[model samples]
Target chain A: MGLLSLLSGLCRWNNNDEENSAARSFILSSVLWLAFVVSLALILATKFVWPDFLGGTAWLSFGRLRPLHVNGALFGWLSMSSTGIMLYILPRLTGVRLYSERLGNLTCLLWNLLLIGASITLPLGYTQGREYAEFILPLDYLFMSILALLGYNVFKTVARMKDKAMYVSLWYFLGSLVWMPFTYMVGNNFLMDTTGLGGRGPVPGVNDAMLNWWYGHNIIGMWFSTLGLGIFYYFLPVLTKNPLYSHRLSLIGFWTLAFFYVWNGQHHLIYGPGPDWLEDVAITFSVLMLIPVFAVVYNFFKTAQGSWHLMFDNSPEHLPVRFFMIGGLAYFLTCTQGPFQALKAVNSNLHLSYWVVAHAHLAFLATFSFISMASIYYVLPRLLNTSINLRLAHWHFWLLCLGLIIFLGILHTAGIVQGAMWLVKLEEYDFVTGSALFKPAVEFIDIVRLLHPFYFTLWLGAGLMATGVMLFVVNVLLTFYKADSPGGRLRSKGA
Target chain B: MYTALILFILAGSIICLGGIYYKRSIVLGILVPGAMLLIIIAFLSTAVLPYMEKIPATDKGVPYSERALLGRQIYVREGCWYCHTQQVRPIRTDAGLGNVSQPGDYQYDYPHVLGTERTGPDLSHLGGKYEDDWHRNHLMNPRPKTPEEEGMAGKVKGSVMPPFSYLSREETEALVTYLQSLR
Candidate 1:
């Protein structure tokens, strides 16, 4: 009788009113960080246009602040919020409460601490000095530990799932966790001999470069892309009230993505110093990446076939759907740009130029960030059982879209001009004359001067984006105040 | 290295099989194993094989001196590599930067600083391009401090490279040493 009772208790459905405090806390914290980091980014943009805006402060200097800004946006904002979304979605899809809300909340606490540690240490000139892998050794260990715990929590929850059929979203979430720890370990040069091998740190020389980009691009491909895509899959079905386009298509996309994205790192080294075959592998796989990207995008569009018109509805309740559609379009564009730029002909001119920076933002800010915003807006109200202000949500959407369009437009133009101007200085030889050839062109300095106007406008667009984020934070906080009343539940339900 | 790869595949397969047996889910078994194989193969082809390749240093490739090493640390700490790329390609745009780089050229760069952007300029062959005094002043203020300083590569009017005047003299010297040692 005791054993039977225990089994029955385990299988019991959680009350609909059960407080999901872990997801709620994580979403709130992520919003605050988003506001903070966007403000930091706006400052960075200002410094680009006016270099002397905040000159002479060591901590506030561009180099130090640059790393902090990147880490903040990536780990602080995106990773934390994605984890929150995953935790929330896991229980709903699996038909059980999270295995341990206590552990989930603990993960959130530790993640915030890790970000705080990075914020303090990176600005204080303590870092490992690699891009995207700059956190000190101790922080790396802390992050990995937290990740392991989170993975265990997720797997435990999935093990007890009431539903027998595994969802596509679950595949992405689980696969992402499996890939991340190894990717982080190898990329950060952890768990290896640090002082051996020519004393150039773990994984020496050009191999370190290969390892770095492998880690770097995969952090995007494996972690962020997977998580964001999973969230996209979850929200698409929920918002549109449609079944997934095809289960087979989703699996094909996942497998192809896992295979091809890993081979793409060396494309960053094209025309540089890696072996020829390595570069060829990178290029070929990078192009092949289109298969998975197209598959996922097609699945998304097909699922939203009848619901496409719903995106035009700007009501507060409908904002999440709009965000998802626009974000989906941005994902398609970002992936198309990825394969296009990976080509050697385009890469030779555009590599190490502002074009790449534009591409990074298109992926991070426009695609994943937008998808994240949609997830947060959709999930937060449902978790809180309170509705947010419609006007504020509208403002947030339009302002951010306008700002991103302006910001990306200026950057793309600047990159092309920069590339063409650099090419004008290229040394040419005429075989007929058997002598050096030269052509008149504007100086590199002249090009820098010409870009000043564009940089100023870029800063302005960033300011607008920052304002939109601040409004979002305000609306979310206001929702919390309204959460306590019985009327709040009714309002949300009515919406 | 080979043992490590074999061990990883073995361990991963066991784990997947265990999960499959416990959950009775063949999909998890297949999917997890497939992902494991693909990532390992990718890692082997890109990182492990490259690390094991035998490439002797070119004539221009040499190890760093102790001071230059210290400078490399300072260069990294200040994140100068964020703006400046260290590799010169054979493309037309990089025609006059220097000799096109080789795999052996980076034999001593443990944590390679082949940066991904040219917000400033490529620094692959920046060594001896200008006087030490020019470097000092340029580091102090990337923009020209005087008319004579105008029209230089990084000292142009609108250059956005941040001033490193906050760095101690020793740190600055070490960083400059590292920069000058690049060639």
Candidate 2:
């Protein structure tokens, strides 16, 4: 980790002087957005039409591209934006300068370079075959170092803050940074035999299953939940024109999420070899999982009630914050439903169905989407040093919600049709074909048929969404200015 | 209708949590819990009220009797809903994977497990499809099995299903029994 940071520091453009910090944020955010556009262009090309990049090569197949698409969304778009948000928020929330612009520069450089390496490696067939953990070993060093830098800088900012009482949002932001890398290390089989690094034939399935769920659930429990809650805690109150409803309930939600959330993870394996006791315990925990989700929602929904006036009047606050508010409610819907699905009786039929995919997308993509957008709306202005285009932001939020719901609906129908047929043994469609390499259009015959209509809807919806993002970045550029930033803008001006 | 229910939930939440935010005083904390309970009840009864029970399980040379019903209990406790489901709504065109979940199929269930996801498939009539070997392989990795053999895999062009190789052979056999008993 240390060695990788040293390397990244070499390439970073240092702009952390009090005068240039926001400029640095704008530049880094642009880098992230560029990568996102490229990645999206690549994925949308395959999703709707094939691009020249995927021309005539087995290694550049959809398999490799899929990883690239997902990584680009998560790390390139989401992560880079997270960096931009943190750069602005830390100083404002704490009333201090960021501890080190150099360290911040190091983190950004490593993150982008890692992506450069991945774009090359994934297509060239140097994958670890793990879901999000697919990057090759040498690249992993940069990832670890970035996380360490993130932790170090966050600690310094918090320690040297003007506000003595830590806000809940700060707790969640710092918690996400501290917890995520630790969770990643364990979930990556970082504990496994590190010697097994390259040219591997299909690794053991059980190990993959464990690692996948560990990462999968954490995407919910840690990544989405913590980030979502951070947005909720900060902006929901702002939208509602109220302070938090109950600080006590806020802590209750946090501890409950931390403890019970881990227990409920195995519910993802209800149909597999996850231990029966663990599964049962998870079901118990899953049912209880609703407690925190609703607690979080109630905390916010109640807070936002009086501010309903603000929602219509303040599109900036309303659009981004509403997604999260609605997302919190959806979280309640999904989690409660999740427990019922965990019950063995339900598992007998629903396992591996599209319904599960729908539920997951709802939580990760849709619900967390609200929170992620809220972060953008709240922080992008500060990063770009001007007001964002409210109309574009509103359009982005609605399209995002609509796209996710409809896309998920199509996928849900496809998965259910597949699951239902196998359960009933329908003679008309139940013919089995023998082949190792799949003859496409068979297992997903229904979905393939459904794709004609569904894909158009999904494609159009996502297209509109990407357009909205473009408009936003344009607005960021349109709004760009050098604000006479206050005293808390950088670290040297602080305690 | 969904709007009404949501509006009610939102309103109830406000009345309950109103004092806490405005006055910085905790009052009407009962609202969130009450709203949640009402929603949970509505959801549960929806599952329970619509169940049917006509499934048959064969044991050895003879048809499985009511005792085979115990397998379903094991199924519920195992958290199979996390991966599989037992219901088949109409808009789906995948493969009709559930054993054609019938209204009469869940008569004996205390809580009908008509799950909501298709990470796996519905098991409404999964009474007797595979030999133990086929199931062992399918459970091990759905990818290895031919679509002609099982699932939408052979039928669908591209799919991914991780093998459940972690179940001990004994646990696998018990689960198999439960699956076979689903018909």
Candidate 3:
């Protein structure tokens, strides 16, 4: 019938040029959507300092908006952006055209629509109450479908690859493709309360917590970190114009990451009521994780051995490599800090503090977002066949770097102060009554008040970062516009 | 510690060495399915299996009533868990948090609201910590201008918590009911 033919036509793989263009369009759309959400989230953060700034409105309240921001940035921005990069990269790495450009476009469309649904519903307070897995059941189904479609497209492309040797990046992409959907189902679906549908109900609270964190930590380690690493592995060598230092080291990094990262979730519950063995195992694996971390770090640094000067070259051309190098440093710091914080002595003080917040931002924003930005820069010129505005790129880089430094530094300092204040004890000498006694002093509320300056600093930092993001968006848009116009010549020089 | 270390080594070897040794298809087939099975088994043994055996009856952690459940939903909706942690760790710093949280403490909790941050404070043992009147006043106005206005001056001076005056009376009462039942 007409519908069937139309469906088959949509599933047909277009020519390479059209397929690549489709991939570029998807990535650009994701970037635009994420940029807007991230900015809105940052602006919403200002209300924390001035609590009643937008208090009366139902949708504008902190509670509703915060989750939207978190989920929006995580799912809408990071996940979507990563997917687009994978779509673009996988074909090139495999030396094959995408299996189905229409499927790719459909997936992107559905994914963005799901994000739109989430944006509307989340602010309207329709949530599952789970961190990272906050989207409602319908959205979860949509997400699973998107992943399935993407997985099929990717795996099929790999199957048809003209290249024989599977690159380190392909290994990571394959592993992540398999792991993400399974992880999502386990975390968001099985253990949820379906009592309204006549189910036996959810697992106990402690078990749910364990499962949630299991899903939570892996979402970062397996999905974001894995894909980001793949992108890093792929783009680093290409940008540096050197082969990977050691393919063996890269493989070691990938395999070790897969085995060790799964056991890391329980560390988030270190001092919580989980069995002692669980916490112990998590800590041990966390420490062992340093192997893969170091492996990748060594590989990257060694790969860029002679090209270290490029990191200092601040020209518009060197921007992506510079971002990648800085992101590499942040990744190292995040991984190192991960195991250190997993230690009981450190977790005790830092668990609930802004220290964790700083760590999350370091991993997500500084590491993954930076890599994604680099990948975008690398891809944009090649995709459009034009150079980006160099001055704007420089502006974007400095503003973001400055903003992140201030934000992270202030939060870490505030965390230490808050932890110390919470643990502070006062010695009391009842001289008038001739009794010597010691008691805990310092009201919790007072500690909260003391953090006002740090909170203000956080707001300021977020503002700067938001501005940087806006500039990047504008720059990309202008470049795209210029490329389409007459007399706007594509650079005939080096990539 | 030794067992954990050994397991870590074994896991690393299986995946890394397996990938290096075997063909790509075989490695991919084993890695993904094997990992999925391992995670499920791990969860079953560590968390789910224990709950099946050790969960207690109503005397310890009863199920939420309709109103309290409603309030709990509201709490989740508001993202209160983002700020106020519900699990009190067994540490000196948490000595004032009123009792180390036991596994049984959250038996009735569905999607466990044991939050990760303490932007506010621990709410695990907040039951009966303050009178309902005080809670109502504080939720409406966490920091009031006059001491006489809401009796919050002496109790919570310089508290940075946002006022929840926008919540309807019914929503406030439901939330308070949920908080009071945490014990």
State the C-alpha lDDT per candidate: 0.80, 0.54, 0.78
- Give the residue spans of candidate 3 off by over 4 A: A1-17, A191-200, A426-440, A484-495, B1-13, B23-60, B145-157
For model 1, residues A1-495, the per-residue Cα lDDT tens digits are 433432232222112233465676577678768877888898899999889777677888888888999989999899888888998999888898888877777777788789889999998878666789888888898899989989998888888876567888988998898888888998888655343233265544778788889899999999999999999889988887789998778877877788779878999889878877778878988998998899899998899989987889877778888888888999999999999999999998888888888999999899988898888889878877767788898899889888999999999888888888878863478889898754325665677788889899999889888888788887876776566334765235532
CAPRI quality level assigned to candidate 1 from its DockQ score: acceptable
Better of 1 and 2 by DockQ: 1
Candidate 1, residue A376: the lDDT equals: 86
* Candidate 2 regions with alpha-carbon error over 4 angstroms: A1-13, A19-55, A162-164, A191-208, A314-337, A426-452, A481-495, B1-183
TM-score of each model, in listed order: 0.90, 0.64, 0.90
True C-alpha contacts between chains kept, each model in order: 0.56, 0.04, 0.50
Task: Please give the C-alpha DockQ score of model 2.
Answer: 0.04
lDDT by residue (tens digit), candidate 3, A1-495: 433432232233222236565566566666767676776768576876887677767788787888877777788778877888888898888888888877787787788789889989988888877788888888889899989998898889888875567888888888888888878987885634453421113677888788889889989988999989999999879878788899888877877787778877889998897777778878988998999999999998888889878877877678798888889989989989999999999988888898998999899889998998888888888777778988888888899999999998998898888888878766567889986443337777778889988889899999888888888887776666555445543223211
The reply for model 1, stretches above 4 Å from the true place, is: A1-19, A192-199, A426-442, A484-495, B1-25, B145-155
Q: Pairs clashing in candidate 3? A: none
How much is A379 displaced in model 1, in angstroms? 1.0
lDDT of 1 at B122: 80
Candidate ranking (DockQ, best to worst): 3, 1, 2
Which tens-of-lDDT digit does each residue in A252-362 have in candidate 2? 565456545554545665644323444565677677767776778678677776765555565454555565566666766676667777787666556566567667667
State which candidate has the highest lDDT. Answer: 1
Q: B1-183 in candidate 3: lDDT tens per residue? A: 345445645655575577655545544566566555545444444445445556444343677877788788778878889889998787767865667788777777876899998888889878888888778877776776574765552236666666677789999999888888787
For model 1 chain A, give the 10-residue run with minimal summed lDDT: A6-15
